[model samples]
Target: MTILAELPTPAPTRAAAPVARPSFAARIRRAAPPYLYLAPALVLLVVWTYRPLAQAVRLSFHTWNLLPTSPITEVGLANYERLLSTPDLGASVWRTVLMVLGILPFSLVIPVVVGLVAARVRGRIYQAMIFAPMLVAPVAAAAVWQWLLDPGAGAVNRVLGVRANWLHDTDLALLTIIVVTGWHIVGFAVLVVSAGLSGINPDYADAAAMDGASRGRITRWITLPLLSPTMAFLVLMTVLLSAQWTFPLIDTLTQGGPSDATTNIYYLLWDYGFHSYDAGLGAAAGVIFFVGFGLIAVGVVALSDRVSHHDD
Candidate 1:
């Protein structure tokens, strides 16, 4: 009776079992499906894009006519040397810059205005009409424009009562190409801008209106800031891919002719590779353009990221 109650023996605490990590093979098995899905695209990219790019770089160091019968002779930067030496290279670059500048009004400014108008109007038919040009095939559109710009029996001349050879005159040819390319591109830009506008929250405009903001002020501060991302994208596309966009029209209508007024780096590369049968020169130009444009594209994206407003 006097004995103290025996202290209950402490129950043995079971240690928590360590969680086992998955085996390497198990992790790989889990990842296999995604990689397998990506494999086809990776293979195609290597086969078509990267392989050709690598071949072009290799060919830039050699002289070849792109003919099976022609042997590739190592030239060791001669192609690049010749490219740098060409006097027209400077002029071509200047013209390319001019072409981009010329197209900017139609591609960016006008399209933005039109898109704003369309957004207010909300007319599907009008939007369809505006976007119709984008649906036309580039070559076909070029062909049609060639007819329209003809000095004789052309709709443009007939309408204006001017007999200017829009695609033949050295001064007019490049301008004509820019106009045609812009016409094709503007519709796409309009559509893009319209879509962007549609995606914006209406509350911003309503809030600005409640604050007695003018329509112009609302657009300048609210609308444009929200649309800045889309606008930046449009600018990037217009600047970087402008040459390719104008290529078909130039090839079909001008063929880089009328004193090469419309010839851009893209056209020059084509002229060297196919027309002049100078594979090394073409490859060298391609490599140079690729590097230059790649850098320019990076700069544009970086600038856009900094400049564009992302907040709602």
Candidate 2:
């Protein structure tokens, strides 16, 4: 045993062989696939989104009529100054805020209630029915609503027994548009909320039930906390896109009037760009909206991160 220990311990064992470093080309070859996989998406994003955004920014500095023959002349901040001083700008922005507020109940609040109740439903037919409105094309839906809300010989007036011009009256037009837009898009919100509901683990609810918690308590506590992320997402989407969602309907039904009562920022931008042929004004408004919305998005995202609760 002494001799075995005294043999210099097998020359103190050679240090482990140093691992051969991969060559630079080998390292690059290993990294290439991920970037290669990402290239198509990156290229398309740059071409479609960023490129147009850059063009819009550049166009905002120049006056143009959107004609090829019309030379673009740089007017610096003239477009912005005109836009800020325009009374319509303030009115349009206020209408946009109203649209967002009106859309919130349909997109977030009611959808959450519907989603929670829908979990008890045992058939796909009811689910399909609930989601059917979202499948209808916006133009087609607008056409149907136009017929239904006609000032004369309309079903809505016939039922209510009043010749109220729902779409043409300045007092009722915006509210009517809001309701129609909500009906058109609420199904999509319900679908998203239902999906979020299905994703929640049942164990928490079951445990709560075993602890003598009522259905209302379970929903208010376990279910809603888990659904907060989806609710936040819906709120964010409604705030950002309510005006856009109403744009097509407004164009089809009201054309932003009975005195521009239904004209949100989106319709105003379209009117400036296409109807009035004021490309620089439209671009300036677009840039302002893009920056403003970008800031709002950042704030909403930060708030959502703080408030949203993940089950895991």
Most accurate candidate by TM-score? 1
- C-alpha lDDT score of every prediction, in listed order: 0.86, 0.88
lDDT tens digits, residues 234-302, model 1?
888888878989998889999999888888888888888788888898899899989999898889888
Candidate 1 regions with alpha-carbon error over 4 angstroms: 1-28
Candidate 2 vs. true structure, TM-score? 0.86
The TM-scores, one per candidate, come to: 0.89, 0.86
Ten contiguous residues with the weakest lDDT in model 1: 1-10
**For model 2, how does the per-residue alpha-carbon lDDT over 27-115 read when each residue is reduced to its tens digit?**
79867987999999999999999999999999999999989998999999999999999998899999999999998988988888888
Task: Give residue 87's error in model 1 in angstroms.
Answer: 1.9
Q: Report the alpha-carbon TM-score of model 1 versus the true structure.
A: 0.89
Clash count, one per candidate: 0, 0
- Judged by lDDT against the true structure, how good is candidate 2? 0.88
User: CA RMSD for every model?
Assistant: 13.4, 11.6
